[model samples]
Target: MGAIICAASLVTYTSVSAEEAYTLTIKDHRFEPAQLSIKAETPVTLIVKNLDASPEEFESKPLRIEKIIPANSEANFTIRALKAGRYKFVGEFHEDSAKGELIAE
Candidate 1:
């Protein structure tokens, strides 16, 4: 009985500690949502799905994150807790049109 209770507690803790998730779609050389809002000081999982035929490099200097998402493929990134501000990102392959920002508040 004690072991069962401990396992249950562990499960609850795991669920509570899980980070929030957000999805961003790339189509027609642009981001579906030009801006995304998130809670400051909270970790999150950002999933970038590329629907375009060419690969794109998700780069953000301020966030210090960069990843290459293959054509028609998706990639996942773990964004650590950040202060309240705006972090801009752009697709290196399509700098002219593919742009977005993460607003933490």
Candidate 2:
């Protein structure tokens, strides 16, 4: 019962965007929105949805975050924006074309 409740809660939370989530779509061998502008030091959730036919690994070094979102699936990660700069991320599955930048302000 507890497990089921927890699972349900998680599903509900992800399905409903409580706060402004920086949504990104993995398509066309690139990351849409190209650049993300966010407040510095605030923990923000990045909801990544891979709309392609293959999986994508949303990996960030400065943010120290990584998550694998299967094809036609969605995944998210939360990180506190640090110093103002450009943070780069790439998809592990398609390292060459799938790439993006997050600009913190």
C-alpha local distance difference test of each model: 0.94, 0.82
> RMSD per prediction, one decimal?
1.1, 7.5
Clashing pairs in 1: none
Candidate 2 lDDT over 1-105, as tens digits, reads 999999999999986645457888999657887788876766678888889988888898877878888889998787665688889888877889888888888
Q: In model 1, which runs have C-alpha deviations exceeding 4 angstroms?
A: none
TM-score of each: 0.93, 0.76
Model 1 scores a TM of 0.93
For residues 1-105, write the lDDT of model 1, one tens digit per residue: 999999999999999899999889999999979899988999999999999999999999998988999999999899999999999999999999999999999
Q: Indicate the residue-level lDDT of 25 in model 1.
A: 92
Q: Pick by lDDT: which candidate is best?
A: 1
